[model samples]
Target: MDPQLQHSVAESVATVVISHPEKRNAMTAAMWRALPPLLGELADDPAVRVLVLTGEGGTFCAGADISTLRGSPQEAQGLAVRAEEALAAFPKPTLAAIGGHCVGGGAQLAAACDLRFAEEGALFGVTPAKLGIVYPSSSTRRLVSLVGPATAKYLLFSGELIDAERALRTGLVDEVLPAGGLGKRVAEFARVLVSRSQLTQAAAKEFADGRTDRDAHWAAQARASGDTAEGVAAFLERRQPRFGWSVPTSG
Candidate 1:
């Protein structure tokens, strides 16, 4: 069966599932290409204020298919780069609900998100070193920004998968759930995110990704925008702030 970008909605949350179980949720060039536009459509919807990316079965993602691995170094890097760009550019809050394995390109994809949660038995790695593939400088920078240089180097050099506890200790995962509870826990986390102010979420998301080249000085303006005002007002009144009520006018 072909890969699919399955989408669903609950109030302000938009859930996107990577449905390619036959391949252990491995991503393909087409799926990587499909993601940015799909996210754009969901972000454009006023009712969609948060995005949850996950795999259909127990696995989060196993990385690129070994079957479709043919490409120049630049081509492979470009494909992975675009996938990361899409996840980073998503306007609302983003979360990765991780399970079995998040390796190679899959690891890079999850790192692009604002937050990540994993099951007890999850594994993570950047296996390019073992595969004799050169890791992109941007991906290396992002990894270092998350887990620090020493740990990043260890992972890259060894290409060894780290367990859930090590991943949590290294700050790769915000929370860890029991194997059976991972899905439900991630759902709860997504719901909690959706309950908050979209504007604050967007600003915070950008701030958390401050190391990214695109998250420059304009973030200050974003944090102080009308959304912050409405959010503070709603907090004082003890009500859910009506957010994503309209599309943001471009500058």
Candidate 2:
């Protein structure tokens, strides 16, 4: 059976819940493919300024459904790769509300987003080492971008779980929320993401993401793009300017 998503549309924020707490919401092959389209809906909705990804029953995710993986390792691995790629391609600001176990491919899912908010006691792990599975190159780069080379190496090679505080210190999570009011805090935090200027945020995110290799031409091209123009115009005009954003065209 397909796992049902708990959808919420409130105040221009689309909250997508991974509902399979019985297994800590481990994503099946189907769920992996389902995510991008669901997120795309929110990404295209002018009314939805933010897209929040979370899991049901206080758990974020435990990675790809391992039991299913045991059946056909190659197929399951392909699904994870495809899903991760889709997530990375999503345009707009994305946030993850992480609680409980965020392990293996779950960690990949969180890392794909623009921002992460984890509650106290959240556990994060990259378990490919344990399974002898190789992570995709882009995912590895994203992880390294999040926490830097040494920390990324530690997480990848060690596959050890890190607490929320440690994850925050390592830059794995943008912020740590109190365990008691985590849900409400996630909602409030998502509001901040929603209220932020899409133009400025999108450009900044794009600029930061593409800055890794430092291609002078690519950087200049982004600035030449109308996003920069609209951002400057909005600031000078003291008004909101619509941003016509699409999936980032550059790596």
Candidate 3:
């Protein structure tokens, strides 16, 4: 089938599947351009409490389709950076459910997500060096933050693929599932995310991403939101808290 991004929402979880199986789900230029707007729609949807990004079939993205680079590598890279930034900025919790190869631009997208769960045999790499192209600074810093300077340098400098075990050891992946188990685990975790307090998740996402200026704003929100009270009451009453707070919509 043609390259595309297929998405659906169920039980407050939005799953975006990258489809380009012929090329191991390599993202084309148009696919990169399409990602941000799609994410914007999902971010604005009240029903979407979480997002899971994964590839169609067994493999995650192999990277950008190299043929798309013939016109202008810079433009292609720019689209990728924009897509990556959009994923990073998505308001709700975002998870990458990875399997097979997650390389080059694929790794960039995975790193942008809040968490990554990879299958046992999944392989990951950041491959700009292999093509003599410079990886974007923001991507580089994000990679360093996830895996530290030395490990990031090793991946960047060598363009070598690492297995899921190594990736988990280096903090590149939050969990490594056995083959055939990724989907079940991701769905289970996503349900847990959906059941939590959105007010807390949104604020924590921003803070974890290094935004310290929202202290007063989050404090005001917390005071106004009834989530804390509900949580306390639920604890005392021996029941699950029904959190009603959601991320504020932008005008």
Candidate 4:
């Protein structure tokens, strides 16, 4: 099949599959341009409480399709950075359910997500060095935040692939599962995310991403949300809290 971002929502979890299996699921230029709008749609859907990004088959993504880099490198990199920023800014919880190779642009996208779970034996790399192209500063900063300066330098400098075990130890991935188990584990965790309060998740995400100016805004949201009351009542009454607040739609 042609390269595309295929998405579906089930049980309040939206799964976006990068489909370009012929090239190890490498993203073409068109695919990069397509991502932000697709994410916007999912982000606006009240039914979508969480999102899971993964590859179409065994491989998560092999990186950008090199053949599409015939244009100005800056133009291509700009598309990727915009897509990465969009994913990072997504209001709800987002997870990368990774398997096989996650490299270059693929690794950039995964790092944008709030969490990453990789299948054992999966390989990851930031490979712009291999092509003599400079990685974008925003992408570099995100990588540094996830795996620290030294580890980020190692990946960026060497363009070498790291195994899942090393990635987990360095904080690149939150969890590592055995082969064939990634799907089940991601589904279970996504359900857990869906059950929680979106108000709390949205606020925490904003704070964690370093937007400290929203303290009063979130405080006002909590007061108006009624989620706090429902949570307290649920604890005292021995029932699950039905959290009614949804993330406010972006203008």
lDDT, each prediction: 0.81, 0.81, 0.96, 0.95
Poorly placed runs, candidate 3 (over 4 Å): none
Question: What are the clashing pairs of model 1?
Answer: none
- Model 3 residue 242 lDDT? 89
Candidates sorted on lDDT, descending: 3, 4, 1, 2
**What would the per-residue lDDT of candidate 2 be over residues 1-251, giving only the tens digit for each residue?**
36756778889788888888889899888887777677666666767777788999899999988887878887887877777777666667788899999998889889988889998999999989989988778889999999999999999998888899999999999889887777788788787766555655665676777745545644565665576677678889998765564434332
Clashing pairs in 4: none
The ten-residue window of minimal lDDT in model 1 covers: 242-251
Per-residue C-alpha lDDT of model 1 across residues 52-119, encoded as one tens digit per residue: 89888888888887666776556766877888888888888889999998998889989988889999
lDDT by residue (129-210, candidate 4, tens digit) is 8999999999999999999999999999999999999999999999999999999999999999999999999999998888
Q: What's each prediction's TM-score?
A: 0.87, 0.83, 0.99, 0.99
Backbone Cα, N, C clashes tallied per candidate: 0, 0, 0, 0
Q: Sort all candidates by TM-score, best to worst.
A: 3, 4, 1, 2
Kindly give the stretch of ten consecutive residues in candidate 3 with the minimal lDDT sum. Answer: 242-251
